[model samples]
Target chain A: MDEQRFLEYVQSGGQVETTDRMPDDYRSKLVKFIEMHGNSELMGVLPEREWILRAPTLQRKLALTAKVQDEVGHSQLIYRVVEDLGKPREQCLADLISGKSKFHNVFHYPTKTWGDVGVIAWLVDAAAIISQKALLKCSYAPYARIMKKICWEESFHILHGRDVVLTMMNGTDEQRELVQEALNRWWGPLMQFHGNPISKEDDPMYIWRIKSQGNEEARQQFLDGYVPQIWELGLTVPDPKLRKSDDGVWEYSEPDWDELKHVVTGHGPKTQERLEFRRKFLEQEAWVRSVVLAEAA
Target chain B: MSEKVQKIVEIADDELILGWRDSEWTGIAPSLEEDVAFSSIAQNEIGHARALYELAARELGTDADTLAFDRDPGEYLSAPLVEERRMDWAHTIARHFLYETADEIRLAALKDSDDAEVAGLAAKMDREEQYHRLHARMWRDRLQDEPRFVDALEELWPAAVAVLPEELRPQMSERLQLDLPSNSLLRGFERGSHSEELRPLLDEMTMVRRSVPGATW
Candidate 1:
């Protein structure tokens, strides 16, 4: 198929499979978009994995472990999709570690305390799920199909996050303080979690129908759904201008788009540390992969 | 402690510590598939630990979380085998395979316990462990010829034997087709003594709980 026809096909809500023919632009765009997602899931694991060993109870420990496992599982599922798109998983990792590719801005920051854990699962995941839910309508059939499972598991993470926050809120003053302090640190990145409010017409991801909504639309959905939940728990959002307008649109201070650009481009505080950590493990375990793959061959 | 409670806590400690060790691989396993698969095994082990602790809690008038997180490091009854911090994949898998093998024998005996509750829980745990055993065996098969894996299995054999009781050692030896070492050699790694690693593991494990004592997480 020619470029215009392929664009028209996806524009009309038509789905494309791996075997389907398409323009180079759409295929390359799809691979880049999806590969970043896979990288995010893998890199996202580090911040939370630090807290798994320190979970306050057996139930929390098991739940945290399972949640981290789900993220890793999501990475596996996502990398497989990328691999099917003609970019191998190994190359994706190498690029990610070498800082040649990007992941979401949120994961590049540090996870400071137990409170950071709760906020991340609750708020960060809430932001991510909004985008992921939009992807359920992706013009790529396989990626869209996998989003069903990813979104379902993500719902559980949101619940787990909310429960952690609620429990701490109901506990002592010190615990409540922990939640507030963490919220303060995380709110900036949370606002920047969705990219700048780029117009759908101008966004290639939207043009190709890889993402069904504009950046602003997804951010609005997150604010509308979660701001009330955060309020009900008596936790404060760091943004002063964060509120709903009379017309039902969310009006907020502009996020630090420069920081988002910088971080996702691999300059966030924890980016080098996290990428180095992943690089260390990948290199250390290279022999294990070689042995296993060689024997399987 | 009652003999039954002592037995329960011992098994619970092993699962708890070993699960803790296994979970260290959650995000950093050799491959993404292994990361996910190995994490499930870790979670299942912790789940088994919780169930076992809950059963013992009923007899001792405590809660599972308290038993799991509030105990002193010196009081932890985990075997030295599970306490060693071997983060590399080969040692991780070697411990996984050996611990699962030992646990299989221990759970089988528990399933036949005269106490109906103990036997029932053991039966349930055994079902979950079937998958864990399969996972361990699959890795063992894949890496059997690798020298590092073979060396790990050899180095960990005595500690693996120490995981079982004297009567159970023979069964484990038979199952693995390896001779049990002398009891004298296994005593140092046996239960009832905490490995130096357990203190730091417990300190990190209980830091959040300790930060705000008696406050519900």
Candidate 2:
């Protein structure tokens, strides 16, 4: 199909399959966008997997392990979509390690304490789910179908996060302080988790219907749903300017778009270390893959 | 602890530590499909540990969390075989195949124990472990020809046998169709001996819980 017709088709809520004809630019854009998501879900595992080892209770350990496992499963599901788009999974991994692609801004930061654990699962994932919910209407039907399961699995993470935060909030002063301190560390990243407030008309991801909502719309939904939950626990978000307006739009200090740009381009605190970790395992385990998956090739 | 309760704790610790090792591959498995599949097996092992811990908790007057996290590194009763660090996929799968083969025999004997609770939990565990056994055999069949996998199996085999008592180990060998190495040829860690690795593993595992003692996680 021609570019104009493809655009019209996607904008009008039509779905495109893997084998469908499309403009070269649209296919490239879809590959890049979807590959980064696969990268994000895979990269997302490193931060949480550390806590899986240190989870305070067996129940917490199992829950955290399962949650991180789900993230990995999501990555697997996502990368398959990317692979179907013509980029191989190994190529995606190589690009991720080489810093040629980006994941969400939040995953680039370091996770500090158990409190960071709760806040991440609660707040960071909350922000992500907001974006994922919009992708249910993604013009790429395969990507959209995967998002359905991804969103469903993530539903527990928020509750698990809340349970963790609330229990700590109700505990000793030290425990409450742990939660507050972690929230302070993570707030900036969480605010920037959704991209800058570009208009949907200006954002190609939105114009092509790869993402069904504008950046600002998803962030507003996150703040609206989660701020009350945060406040009710007597916890504080680091943003002094963060609040809801009379008409219900969340007005906050403008996110450090420069920092978002810098970090996503591979200069965050833990980016190199995380990438190296993945590279090490990928190399160390290459033989296993060669042996197990050789026949398919 | 009573021998019966102590036996339960020993088995729980084995599952707990091995499962922790298994879960190290949550995102890094060679294949994404295998990563997800392996992770479920890891989760199942931990689930089995939790159930076993709960059974022991009743007799010890503590909860599963306390028994799992409050104990010192030296106090964990896991086999020395599971205590060693293993991240290589070949080693991981090799150990997996060996451990599951032995676990099947171990669970079978427990399923006939005179202690009703022991016997009952064994029956449930066997039901759950059916998948683990199947997974192990499947991987074993696929990787049996790979030299590294074959080498890992030979290396880890002794430790795999050490998971069971001498009385039940012959059955493990019989079913696996491999000769059980003499105890002296096996350099595997003994049941009563915790490896140097176990201390650090336990420390990392309990770091968060240790930070705020008595705080709900």
Candidate 3:
């Protein structure tokens, strides 16, 4: 099919498979977008993995470990989809470590306390799941199918996050303070997570139906769904202008699009440190991969 | 503590410490697939630890979390094998394979315990551990010819035997087709003494719990 026909097909909700003929732009765009997602899942775990060892209870430890495992599992699934699209997982990892590709802006920041853990699982994953749910309608069939499992596991993560927050809120003043402090620190990244409020018509990801929603639409959905939950916990949102309009559209102060662009471009505070950490491990373990792959070949 | 409770806690401590060490590999394992698979094994080990702790908790008037996170470093009953920090894949897999082999023998013995409760819990844990053993065996197969893996197995052998009681050591040795070390050699690495690693591990493990004393996490 020609590029125009392929565009018309995907625009009307048609799905594309690996074997299907398609335009070079669609295929390349799909690989880039999907590879970043795979990278995010992999990097996303490092911030939370720090807390796994320090989790306060056995229950929390197990739950957190399982959650991190699911993320790594998600990365495995996502990278496989990327691999099937012609990019090797090794190439993806190399590009990620070398800062030749990008992950979500949120993961580039550091996780601070147990409170950060709660906020991340609760808020970070919430923002993530909104984007993921929208991808359930992705024109890429393999990527869309995996979102079903990814979305289901992510629901449990949000519950785990909320549980951590609720327990802290119900406890001592110090515990509640931890939650609020973490929320305060994380509020900015959470707002900036869905990307700048680009219209779907112009965003190529949306133009090709790689994602089913606009950037602003996802950020709005997140605000509409979560702001009430945040407030009902008697916790304050850091944004002064964050509120619902009479027409039911949620309004908030403009997020720092500059920070979002800078972070995803690998200049966030923790981005270099995280990439270095990943680079160290990947280089150190290169021999093991060689062994396994050589034996298989 | 009753003899039965002490025995249960010993095994629980091994599982808890081993699981903690195994989980340190969550995102940094050799491959993403291994990271996920290894983490499942780690979670299962911790789950087994919790179940064993609960069994002992019933007799001690405490709960599993209290037993798990609230203990002093010197008081933990884990052996030196699981306590050592070996983050390298060779050492990690060696420990995994060796510990799983030792645990299989230990659990089999417990499954025949006269105490029905102990026996029942052992049986359930064994069922879950089947996967762990399979995973360890799969890695062992892949890495069997790799010199580093072979060296790791040999280096960790004494500590692996130390994970078991004197009587169980023979069974582990037989299963692995390796001869047991002298009683004196094994005795030095046995349970009852805390490794230098355990104190630091315990400090990090309990840091959050200690931060908010007595608060639900």
How much is the lDDT of residue B135 in candidate 3?
A: 90
Residue B35, model 3, lDDT: 91
lDDT (tens digit, per residue) of candidate 1 on A1-297: 889988899999999999998888888999999999999999999999989999998889989999999999999999999999899999999999999999999999888789998999999999999999999999999999999999999999999999999999999999999999999998889888888888999999999999999989988999999999899999888889988999999999889899888888889999999999999999999999998889879
- Residue-level lDDT of model 3, residues A136-181, one tens digit each, is 9999999999999999999999999999999999999999999999
Quality class of the docking in candidate 3, CAPRI style: high
| Two-chain DockQ for model 1 | 0.89
TM-score winner between candidates 1 and 2: 1
Better model by lDDT: candidate 2 vs candidate 3: 3
The candidates' DockQ values read 0.89, 0.79, 0.87
* TM-score for candidate 3: 0.98
Off by over 4 Å in 3: none
lDDT minimum window of 10 residues, candidate 1 chain A: A189-198
After aligning candidate 1 to the native by TM-score, how far in Å is the CA of B105 from where it should be? 1.6
TM-score of chain B of each: 0.97, 0.96, 0.97
Q: Is the docking of candidate 2 incorrect, acceptable, medium or high quality?
A: medium
In the range B25-88, model 2's lDDT, one tens digit per residue, is: 8877887788888888888889999999999999999898888878877788898778888888
Candidate 2 total steric clashes: 0
Docking class of 1: high
* Cand. 2 TM to true fold: 0.97
